[model samples]
Target: MNVPSNRPWPRAAWLTLAGVVVLFFIYWSTVASTVAIWRRSETFAHGFLIFPISAWLIWQRRREIAALTPVPDWRGLILLAVLGLAWLAAEVARVLVIQQLALVAMVPALVFTLLGWRITWAMAFPLAFLLLAVPMGEFLIPPMMEFTADFTVAALRLTGIPVYREGTFFTIPSGNWSVVEGCSGLRYLIASFTLGTLYGYLTYRSLKKRLLFALASIVVPIIANGLRAYMIVMIAHLSDMRLALGVDHYIYGWVFFGVVMLLLFWIGSFWREDERVKPAPPVVEYGWGLPGGLKPMLAASLIIAGFWPAYAAYVEGLAPNNLAVRLQAPAGRNGWRLVAPVTDWRPEYKGMDASLHQTYGKDGRVVGVFLAYYRYQRQDAELINSQNVMVRQKHPVWSNVGEAAQVVELAGRPVTVIETRLRSPHQRLLVWHWNWLNGPFTVNPYWAKFYEARARLLGHWDDAAAIIVYTPYEERPENAARTLQDFLRDMLPALTAKLEQAAET
Candidate 1:
């Protein structure tokens, strides 16, 4: 039997294979389970399609993957370990699963490590294309919503419809129809872009063509979404909000989005070239018989390994004390009435000044609950006012009913008051009556260690902040409030001050 002499696998493949196995185990044991739970979350449930889509894409690219140059890379194994830990920590911290998709980190490490620097550089595009998995930049939502609303309003007006228009909203005298949150077209924009990207990649081999189609995928969705909103509003105006805003609204969107996507695919077909190409052989090299100077690399690997665990431990140790306390349920506090059972109420975490909550109803068929909390230790203040009202115009999935400010006294001290109301019917609302820190935050030693390690890598830290969200009957808002109060009470003043400073900046 003859083996390729140029192949470096005997030195590198076995190690990488072992590393891959270990990473897969870590994923299956921890990250995968957390991802499974995330699949049930509103922000990431769409990620359920990632695997199937990725599989299909890989299948399409099988010929390409097979043709890539193969080189041995023992060093990549270390990177593999590093990425695995990142994925695991992301899972533990309840980070957005899309943001943590292993392919973004792992695939690059695998490709670069084993294939040598030159080949990995050559194939950066396909490797980067894998990053479609990392759920990123719903940032497009605001702009997309703006465009959709503008287009819809204009289109409606052109059709001889009387409309009163403001920023992203308009009222038609035909009925009291305001293009609220759900109409913002964010869902369709995201869905269309995802599907469009897949279609572009599979069909267009040329980078230029792929990019053009990808841009079109993003643009067309917003246009189509606007049209969808216009149609629904027109229908409702002609008929009633019941038919448009009722059960049929989402069904209508799905139907229209499907049609628009079909059109996009049809238009995209014009750009594809099905030219034949010959199979290419993998380039291989094997000059280094033995790797040199292992001690420094080994030390570096060990040092890196300790990063996450240390951060996790620190966070655990710093875990804010839980100050469980019951706050009296308000029957009709500030026009927000309790329509559910009065059950358990306790502060869940100790970070902010205080938190308080109590349930107002039963489990399944309960009406609603009331929750309130104060954040003396404000974290991520920028995020508090980041809600894009214009985006809500087309995507009406998120609604800010209104907000009013009143000077409220807390601990007998006057503080700035902010209250915003958001209404989302389909989403299960949980009043996080406690620390609303964004991304990984927990005082568990393991979590703290993990966070610390990540900060060293990512080179940034997030401040602990508190936010109180209110929703219908989905969860016990009051209980959430209590949880918040306790957590805040336990968070020492020094830590609270640090968090506040972090947030202010």
Candidate 2:
């Protein structure tokens, strides 16, 4: 499959260019969202480089892309249509990550639709590499934190330093150390993985070696990150928390990463094969009917891709305003009476139009019932925003000590709720929370968002609320969870009605 890269050209390049123009408008919102992340998030700031780098990678193979025989594969259109639907669903669900990825996929899909599978296949690596542009990899932080803690604790113990390991915090004879989110080597892992993939593509022709090197890029960084955290802790421990405790910790971590990557590249140089890029061949005229040429393809592509945002726009225009909602506490039930919440600490429920905080007492224990009601759900005011948490990190007086899961009946059905054990200086608490997205109770924030998107798209009321239960625990997590469970069974009926009424009004 070969063709001339220069001169009079083929019909495919012109068609693909038109398709790209249509794509720009179709994915404008997604592009704006991704760009905002690149500007805002320091962690995903590397995403800003991915687009230009991908384009450069493709340009280095310009002759290869241009030389391949392009026969428009309608299969690409089929895939593109399917991806468009998926993107629509993602948009409706308000999952920015999913929608942005689907939008990025249009590049290859358009390539396939206009340039055919052959040309698209030749440029597959660069096309796939475009995914790094989306701001993702935040999910890696938790596991990275755990790995750091495990590695640091093991290293400390091996070095004959007395240590006690907890969840993310560990006690050492010299000082106390905790693996915070910053200590999680996610930034290193993402950078290493991205670089390693590109290096493997440019350096190796063999698939096996490419995969092996790419895997190494992933694996090495994880282990290296763990070791990096361990060394940083050791440096802090040895220096009596003077050296690595400041900005030097960041400097050391990045410096260590750079050295490790340099070493990786040096070793990979042994197996490095050239890209063998070639100049464009002499002009060879080729012609094929574009199934209606560039105009029709552009029109069809615009029609198919533009439908989602068009619908979203129409829906937004017709959506009702419900911002005047007033929230009230449910009536007392099962030997439980409503009382004022007797603490300064309030659950952080962001952008609530209305909220209810009532304390209920049964037997000897006091329970806090909080309902965060929103008349309409939007980006920041959504029921499941991360800002709406039991604790905020700025002051850092309270810490989530542990997680305890248990089954509890809600709305006449058994649902598993994630219970968290929180500890302050003087108080220990067990917290259970779930988002009431119309009806389904979900612990996952994203699922709540998905439900909100679906309901809103269907022209249904998008009113939602979060229900939180707090119970004091003495020494046992089980007792605290049991207290919450009993509280739910007694109060769920009235609570459900109250929430249902919130949506209705």
Cα-based TM-score, every candidate: 0.58, 0.91
User: lDDT by residue for model 1 over 186-260, one digit each (tens)?
Assistant: 767667777777777778778788888889987887778888888988888777555777788888988998998
Best by lDDT: 2
Worst 10 residues of 2 by lDDT: 1-10
Using TM-score, give the best candidate's number. 2
lDDT of 2 by residue, 1-505 (tens): 2332433235666667777777877789888999998898778898888978987987887766666555554556666788787787676656778888888888888787666566677789988998888888777776788788888888888999889875677788778777888888888888888999999998998899999999999989888888888898888888887878778888999999999999998999899876665565433434332455445555666677777778777767655654877667887888998766655567888888888888998787688988888776766776765577777553468776555456777767778777777777777888898778777787876677767777777887677888888988778878877788888888888887888877777
Question: Model-by-model lDDT, in order?
Answer: 0.50, 0.77
Candidate 1, after superposition: displacement of residue 115 in Å?
3.8
